[model samples]
Target chain A: MAFQLVLPDSKSVSQAPSPLAYAVDRTFFYAAAAGALAIILLVIYILWEIGGQALPAIGRSGASVLVNTQWDVQNSSFGILPQIWGTLYSSLMALLIGGFIGVSIAIFLTQDFLPHSLATVFRTLIEMLAAIPSVVFGLWGIFVVIPFVRPAADWLHDAAGFIPFFSTSLSGPGMLPAVIVLSIMILPTVAAISQDAIGLVPYKIKEAAYGLGATRWEAILKVILPTASGGISSALVLGFGRALGETMALAMLIGNANQISLSLFSPATTLAALLASNFPEAGAIERQALMYAALVLLAITLVVNVAGTLILLWTSRKMAKA
Target chain B: MTNASVLEKPTATAGAAIDCNIDKIYYGKFLAVRDSNIAIEKGKITGFIGPSGCGKSTVLRSLNRMNDLIKGFKLEGNVHFHGQEIYDKGVDPVVVRRHIGMVFQQPNPFSMSIFDNVAFGLKLNRFKGDVEERVQHALTRAALWDEVKDKLKASGLSLSGGQQQRLCIARAVATQPSVLLMDEPCSALDPIATRRVEELMLELKNDYTIALVTHNMQQARRVADITAFFSVDISQGGRTGHLVEVGPTDQIFDAPQEKLTKQYIGGEFS
Candidate 1:
């Protein structure tokens, strides 16, 4: 026998849910999204207000503020060229010294020359160094590095005083200490990241090298290092960025001088050190000028970060194709 | 078992060839390969076939001292390559490996161009004369030149699986080693690629001694002039691999002396 079937109404099926419930769900989602948008907009607005107030000071002060030698805030005069030079010069010196030591340590740790247990111990020590705060490093630098470096600075002043770089008076805390402190500060960052990069090189490739009769050093130089070049570059950039923006440590050792000197032992100031030293007591105009310094710092960091991102993207693309 | 005991001693006929008598142990305790013996002809294809954990690969690796990479691995017997003990204290593994190249189970081409990968070994050994010509010659010998000649600058990874394996083979052979060890070189390839590799191997044996470790018995039967079969015994607390038989491929398949060999060859034990 054939059975008859019944069909439900399409209108009731379509209208099963209450519109209020839908409205409540939609409202919650929109509210959460709007809250996130508000936070972002608030941050952007604050930055814009600060940046707008600071940029005009540079224009009012003119190219002298950017390229002049003196930074006398008392006479309504301000120049950051010396400070900029100090910052770049010290950071570059730090990078060169720190980068060499850090990459060497990384290679030693990752290579087969050392015993496994010793390598582990060395790696652990480096990681611990990274955990020490910048303030602690500053204190250590003042107490320990100053005495040892004072003699060297004096020697440079006496022996090589004919050279502009070595013409400093060699009294106390200065570019030499600042550069040394910055180097020690950035050491852990470079070493740890470089070791991590070297470790990321696949074992299979090294084995392939060995299978082809490559010596331990040959395998590392030809196969492992090239494969890890991108990561190592990123590590170096990270160290550079850290050195560029370091504040408390540099301030403690940089002597707070705005005069640029060619000598490693001479007194000089960096932007962060300058900001830290005088930001609390600065008047409205002085504060705006300091903010302009901050703005310059921000621009420099932004450029560095953008460059790092581009490098990372290009390397990843190359790796993917490889 | 009686025949295995007799085969433990080197054949008097192989007076001038390389003999690898590998007794592998793991952790300084567990015996992996027990009294295994094989004589490698100077320029011929010899295939080793066994089930998983049969220690065929261990014996293959012992020839070039590849087993030295493993921690706590020890060997009791000697592997003599051209009458010189490979395990001697002064014998450098690097120099040994330079004269004896290897291809792995997987196609592990470097992340460089096809030309560069082939040129890697030569450069590592500091081959100073006409590198381009040597690289081209190696590529042609490995049967990869025609396919990759136009794209030598392309990354080795960009090639198909077969092409990559051939590229690896080219890289290995470019060093002009006397012996070429292949650890299941065609296992990761398709049937067509496998056939191409097999043909290449046959062609290569004329110039270099070839030792192959494979699980595919048919591949062993097709390409190997001599075949060695290994089996595992677990009663010894650790897996003990022993060479059950070694002979010409036809004799081993048609008239195996032992019942176990017959069972394995007739496909009775799945």
Candidate 2:
């Protein structure tokens, strides 16, 4: 026989699965659904526990807890406005520095600028930064980062005294060191994810760019960056989350001062740092206030996550339309 | 082999747009193709027709130095574009590509708006003229202006497959390159789309020299003025591809001198 084109019977094929396979398939589907439901339930349960514990503080102080800046343990007046400002300010600063460095590193590694072996080595080293424990990072920040940064902070304060960011003289652990440490802490997270995003851009798209007489830099800046923007932004958001939740480094480096000031050299405290520093030595009412502060931090993080997701959706839609 | 009897000698004719004289093309010491000579004449469509694994695409890619992107792809030969040695040490490939644009086997438009896709080359070259006018001119030349005129702001990928391929053609033509290389431009398209692209090629011959690598013999006969045939050789225990013949399309299809060409056209083997 020369050849024959045999057509499968669609009716038989659709119904031909073994009974065991059907049972296994259904079982897997139900198992995955249950796992997803469990995750959602766990989140709700945690929120419930935190909210219930924070209720005592919320009832005792009302809205005064948010706007109050003085935290006198003896008088039991707990105001976390300064800590909230420090938390937002520090995380945003970390995001700006870390996001730029991470995206640059990702582009450098994935765009064939480095030799393959060298890129691999650099990538591995960057990833290993994440494996170092947070406490170790804190210790490193206290010794190496603070010492190295003190002179620069002092010079900035002297030279640019009129600017509020550099008005205060550097005495010891302060916002500058804390921001620097937080930035380094989140760099690996941002860089690794960004590398994956940039790497996933199709080779064909890059070729199209080069075919149009684009230099390597031109191709990367124009074609590859825009194509990977969505993924890169997601990576930044995750890095932001990592920076916001970091406690050990911030508690060790930030001066933990109760007063609010714009100077980077001035001591400051974040919500995570406040919780970590005050919970152990707190009396009963102070514990409730710390719990309430934790709840505020949780709300802020949730809002950031939601905003990131919305930004991603809006960008994709804009890209499609444009 | 006896087939060398019909092979054309390397000639640098005045009308040639791109001239290639090759001793060997190797991917990391493994000989992929050898002993090839082909010239793409100016203002005419030259087609490279060959079976799979015959290195037609490899030779086509070498003309524009697009093979430089591939790791270990080495061409031990000379490829001249309009009397300039494109592979010379000091000559930048980016500058060479500016004058010779290409359309890939797949429709590879950038994930950008249609207008931006066409304007990409113009922007890179820093064209001082109106970009909007140039984009419209290219789309009109590719026969895609009417359908996409109102939606130039839409993403290039939002179009149908045939439209996307045409959009890519417009993108390549927007920079006004002298030579256009199309590697299997119609292989991914339907017959109707293929016919439209063929018509576009016929219209583009007035201004640009085109080099095409195609698997379809009918397509070669339809649009190509001259055709180069490449075939694989396994007699030496390695399947190294080499050029077999280069002549007018009618002669290649109807009065081929080589027995291999006759056999291939007679449907003896793919």
Candidate 3:
């Protein structure tokens, strides 16, 4: 196709560009550019400082720092294998439990399972769960949650004792309670975002499904949920981030045991838990070890957030095309 | 298995398939529409032509209990579909909707693969046999089989506007509904896509009782066998829709009994 310069067929237009307008435009552009640069500068500064502080530990431990279990103070050796496993296992466990609960709450609120006024009240209560400080949750986990959950842990140990994950004897403050507390703390983050995602579906789409003879459950499962999958995945990512970086609550209740074990009943120390509990009493090498663990947390969060954003972007572009 | 010949079998035979006597419709005490009485004939296309907010779409939606979805929407009326009172105390809207599928004002193919969108209803209802065959038949009937047969796995939204509408039509027809309600099915398309959708509606009427709500008088004239004219009545609950006339398409267009109907069709008023 040949391109044609189609011009407006009528009136005279102003001929000259104003110098004042150009000045104002340039000033505004530079102001916005400066704001963006500040954020980049701040992130770089934090990463550089943390990396420099952690360099001593990183050089001494080599690649084995991530996988080696022992954290000997006298031997001057430090590794985070148990902490890494603890962080991964606890966060994954939290996701499995919290993700289900959050999605369920979101679905219930969005769908017609409850009356309008009732759903609103329930939604508010669930959102309120997020507003309470993490320290408060930590206290609750120590006193009430740990005691209340011991029986369930004992029951799991008895029922599924053949499995390595369930072989350990029950304890009040360990991986299981830590997982429970993390799941609770992250519930609102997951539910709130997932609810928003579910709400984004248009009424016309639901009407189309209903017109196709789908039951409410069928329509929800086959259409609405799939349509909101991107948002839900983003919610899970946020939940995972919250669970992974959680320090105060895990440090308070996790018993901070620094050894890897297959059993869920065994006490464990997550990266955040170890850093939070040991940072205040750290010597030169100990401080570097804590900073090393913090760097890993930072890297993981950055990766997770980027992946989550890409997922959201992909789904939105697909939605726009549709 | 042949597409055109299979859809050639006429479905509706005689009088009314859907009989409506809607006294009023309300959204939380705010009256939306009121007083509609019409007999939608079987095996033919019945066109509902009126201005905006004339309750043409409302009446069509009521036929299959689609109003049940709205939070505060309630209607005082009886709508009987194929001799069953659909508004009865013990009626399941799911079953009612299965028998009378609808096409929307906008093309709304589910955000899924073309083949999957067509197969959704069958899967939901747990079709016992040959899902792929049924999907193919539906697509073929909608006259989209030739264009999209090779791209069954492609997203339904990937198609052009006209093809998307046809895919939606295929989706609606997949479950073998006896009656099809369309609310301005061509309003969102270009002239070419509009013409294609209009043609598809005419072909589908042979196998389904079609109720269409349209603002386009030319479309009504071209496709409708029977026509219902509605206009806003100010006296009964303030600007509520009332059915003005219903008759054979030719008579309504050429020799309309109601002056309002004449004015509407003659372009005297909206």
Candidate 4:
């Protein structure tokens, strides 16, 4: 037998593709590059707008915009203190009211405490309510909330008129109506997000809790709620963001006065409401002032979103470690 | 040994064994498991052997009312634990499960430290003794104390696969449940891990009544005192599972009553 060198077939060698074929997959590379570039440009544009106008207004106004009680935009005197205070106060009120009701509704939905059909109907109603326009809510606030709150305002004014905060002028549509409208607006967001978060808790963990002789309430309190805490926090942050940025509803309901008052029944203006009421009438410096207000609102939203992201990341990391 | 004696006290003789009769139906029509019955003697390990979708897991889940979690699952039968009807309206399933602990197929240690995982049941049940001591004792019983004692505070997920399975077993037994239900506890483990779990099961039988579901016939022979064989009847178009035969492990292996049992033990169709 003649010893002959055996060689591998060239057919298999020819079948293997070059590295460029793997590296330059067209569809994926194009989509990824486009997404990255779009995000970069969006961030850059936002920074430029804020830097060009908002910073200058803030620097010029200094502590007066934050501390002074007056805002006379026509006469070139713009102070945001009252608007800032009103925004904080109303948002806090809305959070307190919405948080309680939303979490309760979420618990009810997840715990099978309601009939399945009823739960479904209620969930649908909430979703529809969420999708309803803010302008419609504002109209409802004007027509219904004002009349309903007038009696309560009268009672507070009669009972505690000596107190500065309760010296209610029995105003038409003001802080109280605005707060109520905001609470209703934020409710569906909080409830829907919280229900989803609670739903994401694994069945096994809940089953383990039940298997350990825990009561239904005990299992929810200890296992379900703790596991879903990060998600719930995100939900609350989302609701707060909505409350902060709400403009049309607040403008329609909040009497549109640029004065800070401790009374719930008094007329007050949030930053959003102020911008909505004055942005159309603003001139050179006034436009810059409105932009500054927008910047502040944007900063607040960014902080909330960043905090929510951090909380979610920390929770997932904790879960991974566990 | 004292703990073993406590578990063996009621069912010292074969006449006093707990009998489980489970009939399960899904949605008013589909039968998941039909007229399944088993006698679990105290302090003995009983294994259910079957193919996929063979109702072994359904029967196991029914022992502790874990089937109640399923939306349309309904059961009509008696599971007598110390002569009490488990399915009675007044009897709480949570309370029943407390006394009849369970270990799932996956090593589902909670998202907590090893110490906390072992302590979970004790705290839930308000077990009012020294928590540390109980956790240690349970860990020791599950044969995981030696490897994990120094790292009790570490995350339970930090353990190896075998160790996590053992940790779950330890957590289940921590509540001092008289009966333990394990649903293919070693199916996810490797060969070495499987052997370790088998050894642990044997040791556990001295102090707990164990009902195990396994697809591995050899594992059934190795660990079970009694073996119940189940098969899905696919002739009806949709699958419905039923128990084919059940008896002492030795009898099932040596002289099976049914041809299917014989074929199964002979490794013909497993």
| CAPRI tier of model 4 | acceptable
Structural similarity to truth (TM-score) of each candidate: 0.86, 0.91, 0.92, 0.86
Runs off by more than 4 Å, candidate 2: A1-33, A307-322, B1-13
Number of backbone collisions per candidate, in order? 2, 0, 1, 0
* Fnat, one value per model: 0.74, 0.74, 0.90, 0.56
Minimal lDDT window, size 10, model 4 chain B: B1-10
Candidates 2 and 4 compared by TM-score, better number: 2
Give the clashing pairs for model 1: A165-A262, A165-A263
Over 4 Å off, model 4: A1-36, A74-77, A111-121, A152-170, A259-263, A313-322, B1-17, B23-27, B146-154
DockQ of model 1, rounded to 2 decimals: 0.54
Per-residue lDDT for A1-322 in model 2, tens only?
A: 3233456764443334567877899999999999999999999998899888889999999889899998889998999999989998899999999899999999999988899999999999999999989889889988999899888887888889999999899888888888888988899989998897787677888889999889899999999999888878988998898888889889998988887888888889999999999898888888888889999999988887887677667655645442
Q: Which candidate achieves the best lDDT against the true structure?
A: 2
Evaluate model 2: give its lDDT.
Answer: 0.88
Pairs clashing within candidate 2? none
lDDT of 4 by residue, B5-24 (tens): 23323434453246788775
lDDT of 2 by residue, B114-175 (tens): 99999999999889999999999999999999999999999898898789989999999998
Candidate 1 residues A75-187, lDDT tens each?
86877888889888998899999988998899999886688999999889887887888888888878888888888778878888999878876667888888888997888
Number of the candidate with higher TM-score, 1 or 3: 3
Lowest-sum lDDT 10-residue window in model 3 chain A: A1-10
